[model samples]
Target chain A: MTAPFKGYLRADGRKGIRNVVAVAYLVECAHHVARQIVQKSDDMDVHLIGFPGCYPNDYAFKVMSAVTTHPNVGGVLLISLGCESFNRERLKSAIEASGRPCEVLVIQNSGGTLSTIQKGREAVERLKAIAAETPVVDMDVSELVIGTICGGSDGTSGITANPAVGRAFDWFGAQGAACVFEETGELVGCETIMASRAITPELGAALEACVQKAEAYYTVMGYGSFAPGNAEGGLTTQEEKSMGAYSKSGAAPICGILQPGDIPPTGGLYLLDVVPDGEPRFGFPNISDNAEIVELIACGSHVTLFTTGRGSVVGSAISPVIKVCANPDTYRKLSEDMDIDAGKIMEGRATLDAVGQEIIDSVLATAAGQRTKSEAMGHQEFILTYKAFDPLGPACLPLKRA
Target chain B: MPEALILLHPTDNVLVCRETIAPGTVATIDGEAVTITQPIEVGHKVARVDLRPGDKILKYGAPIGSMTKDTPRGGHVHMHNMQSDYIPSHTRNASGGAA
Candidate 1:
């Protein structure tokens, strides 16, 4: 079956569902100015994203570089405070290297907030013009890189939405689209089972080690990824929530492991390890839901499927998030904010396969440019912070191309 | 009639409430009549069998946590009686709103 959609063609030969002009603030100091520019521009296609750190961080720089060059991004307008440790010149070069239009504004050099806002607005107009010139091309499902994440999970998550998304992932993986499921922090109890699904024994071993690392890291932090909201929603333990979140990966054979900026080399199932490597010095691995969404976008996911039992209304800057509500009650409360209601599976009014097909159909429709509930409501949430990681070992990416 | 409780897996000793079950509600469990001893909200778990303090709480046929106290059949299985073997779960009240 050929699933076809019209997409903005990038110079790197990747297809983008959205042609967005990103107005990025390199430091927290420039955030106000950059935000003003996006707000004044008043265009849904213009988005705001940034790193708030004034200190130098390799992880921040790498994620910034990955997001700016993401296929969904058409052009970029970078705002710098001029005194921050972030490498603006290198980031601009990386964006330009991908053949996308990029410009940087220094708030200090451009005469502070008001003047920079004016100039940034003008730059956004120019970038939008260049972005609009991107040719529209017919794209197929095989070229899509889709990511799945479960947030605000509960007992019903595993029973409904999460497994339904798993079925969707299975379908997408079977169709040869790159399917990524994430955060070893949430995979604590399922590591052994997940490893058994890996294509090679070496990759399987690497998968197990990644989860062990997450468990150790969280143990040091005095907290697991399990949150208060989870307990309130009937999830009693970290492992229970982990099992619920684990269903989002579906049943596909694990292909490889990916660090934040590592794009999948082939069309298959990949596990995105969001936990920082080495000692846990940087607090929680992901501060919030949006951070994980950003990591998924950094992995070059064209779209993300977010399954929620407690309900989360978040859409990323570069990609669309399809919210699949697991609880019928939450779906009733946030009906306007939800995309698919997998809660019906519990009522027996609909089957899991039916909801899974509905999710896939919603993805194809979203890929073809139908706005998700969050997107239509103008939810362009983005966040980035400090973290560190050593390069992935050879065993992690057995299928990686040089 | 809507199913009051569902066993996710054949081996699971905990049954999940398909809908809210109020106190004194009569529900049939495995051909045996049992009365709901406490309020069980939708998506919450109930003991499928008599559970002891050291017994593991099984859901989806996997051990999720351990029981901290004895719970009779159809009793609510939640944070009050079960605790994680990996890490302690926090609540808004338990962590002083830090959660």
Candidate 2:
């Protein structure tokens, strides 16, 4: 079988489904000006993402580096409030080292906020022109990294979209694509079952331990990752949600356990341990769905499959999000926002295999340059904040095992 | 007949309501007819058999939680009578949440 998509070939020889010029604000003080620059550029490919704090955090630097250097990013414009300590110079050098056109503008050094926005806008315009020069290359399914996340899930989600995505993940795995599923907080109850899928006994133990970390972390914060609306949508407990979420992995062997920004050395299904290593310092594992998706993109995911039951209308900035609706009822109310109707499985109008194939078809189409509903609607929502982690221990990456 | 309630997994002790079942609606379970004791919304769970307090609630063939109070078969099973066996869940999980 041959790969069906032609992707943007990057200078590093990696391929990307989207070529985006990231306009990132180093601090909250520069966010408005960066937003203005992206707005003035009037390009769908110019995306906004930023960290709001002024603190110098190793974790933040790592995440920002991974995100800016992501294969999907063709060029970057760094907007900084000169007083902040986010280290814009290092980031600018990183982008330049990778051969992408990069420019850094400090609100204080660029002649204040207004002139900076004007300068940033011109930078984006120049970046767009430079980004168009990326070579087109035929990328195999093996070269693609895809990720899945379920949000606003309800009772029907597990039985429908989640499992369908699992099936799709299975197909991708068989074809040698790297697949990622994340949010350890939501997988608390399924650790035992999830561990059993690991490629080696040691990796299985590592998988179980990460879920334990998430369970303990959320417990200290006074809430499980299970949300209130989950109850309203007929989800009664965390384990049940975990079971449903577990289906998104399909039946693939757990190839590796990765932390945020850790790339998979090869193809197969990998579980991203989003829960911070060590004790809970931050309030929650992931503040929002986009936060998780951003981590997946940083790990080199070209497209994301987002399964929603209660109807999440979110899309990411660097990668296109294919919203798969799991509830027939929710799909009816938000048809325009959804890309696939896995909910038909509940209605008995469609089978899981059909929807699974539909998801795969959607992925290939999106990879081949057709815009997703969210991308066409201009939903480049992105956010990055602070969190720390110890590097993945030997068992987590397990090169010998995979 | 309204779309019959479903048993998500063979070992599950809870029936997922595929459609809303009004109070007193007689539903079949394990070849036995059980009358619904309360109004249950779609996506909610119903006791597949007589449930006693301390009984582990099963769904998708896994233990989701445990009963906090005794309830007859076909009775609505939710947060009031059932609680998470794991950590305390967010109490206000409603329509509004971060995307």
Candidate 3:
């Protein structure tokens, strides 16, 4: 009930734990220049992220717009290759309208990569200066938006880290915080169980249908969206992995279902349906863990709880990722990358509730500016790819419709 | 069971090994000791009870897959014996998953 964290209040009224200056490239051609700008800035708070397509997509625009104005982002510097189909002006105007300091540098107009990088570095300095003066506001637990994703999962993920995250989610629910768990591809087998936990029957049906869509999509792609490390790590089936992945939801009632770029309107548990609506224009719903993290970030998650049994060490650009090791063996191998030792639950040395509290405490500490292991290790990875959507059905956006 | 073996749910038909179990390691399950038939790696599953082929494999109290071959108590349960009823799973080099 107490506001224990102080957040940078954006001009648009959203609060952010990290005021990052994002240098986004409009297409793959400008990626080098954008990366150079951020790398040369020597500022940990500045990051590079971009889409690779030259084709303009409404879905891309929507996600990019939402991400650029995300609460974690204070300012944006868009780098365009000048000839790509991506609408830089539209993206720039959206950021400006959000009252964030944003500008676009067309590489061709700037003469070349060197010129753009130099201009981009100066832009980062100005953005950082603007970000520094942003007002700090006290935020309550109720105002926090937390997300969970499981990557490189194995057998222990379900029994330990995933369930522990679920327990932390239960605490977040008790504190009235908005929490999100995602990857419909990973939630395939647990749809019925997941739907039963929905706040309403309509929402339950909507949740089932989303998983159905993901199953069909992945089936067409010739793979179950699982990785080889998963098997080596002792995961036998995709649905089995889904059951383990489902544990991160804890036992909270599902309040709503969302697509990327759609922020939760009220505090409760929600499901983020990352699969594209129409035909699978994108090869995979999520290319990797960071892709899914980006969608969660697009939904305005302040921090992400990442469970990895095969030892993935990725942090997001816009939000800090708290890595929870699910296997005691993997934990020993990559202790430096992990924030919480949920693996102890598997070893019987620690109870689930204890590790769950550790996760919640990590969230509070990260919000209070104590960098997570990933953040302190400077793992600012990001990726945004193209996809299409046919708008949400009647039941998906309950809060927005209500 | 060795402290390393955990039953996620009362209804689960498999036990998750918290650490690798060498052959001949005896685990006390439900107060009964069962000797490991084969080496089971950490994070792998072991049959909690006898199961026939086509029987549903339950973990986390949910059906993860189905047994492709009969499995005995204390036997290692993985892709060799069980497979997902949903979309077929793949490793890095193989593509012959059941569709």
State the DockQ, from 0 to 1, for candidate 2.
0.63
Cα lDDT of model 2 by residue, A334-381, tens digit: 999999998888878899999999999999989888999999999998
The deviation in Å at residue A174 for candidate 3 is 2.4
User: Can you write out model 1's per-residue Cα lDDT over A1-402, one digit (the tens) per residue?
Assistant: 755999999998878999999999999999999999999999998999999999999999999999999989999999999999999999999999999999999999999899999999999999999999999999989888999999889879999999999999999999889999997888888889899999999999999999999999989888889878888788899888988888889998999999998899999899999999989878999989999999999999988999998989888888999999999999999999899999989888899999999999999999999999999999999989899999998998888767
Model 3 regions lying over 4 Å from their true place:
A1-3, B95-99
Write the number of the candidate with greater DockQ, choosing between 1 and 2: 1
* Residue pairs in clash, model 2: A228-B93, A228-B94, A229-B93, A229-B94
Q: State which candidate, 2 or 3, has the greater TM-score.
A: 3
Off by over 4 Å in 1: B97-99
Compared with the true structure, what per-residue lDDT tens digits does model 3 show for residues A229-332?
Answer: 99988899999999989989999889999889998988889999888887876798888889899889999999999999989999989899999999998999
In candidate 3, position B75 carries an lDDT of 89
What is candidate 2's CAPRI-style docking category based on DockQ?
A: medium
Candidate 1 C-alpha lDDT tens digits along B1-99: 667899898999899998888899998898788999788887888999999998988887778989999999889899999998887787767655554
Residue-level lDDT tens digits of model 3 in B1-99:
346577878999988887888899988777799999798888999999998999898887899999999989988898889999999988766756655
Candidates, ranked, TM-score: 1, 3, 2
Candidate 2 chain B worst ten-residue window by lDDT: B90-99
Ranking by lDDT: 1, 3, 2
Pick out the ten consecutive residues of candidate 2 chain A with the lowest summed lDDT: A393-402
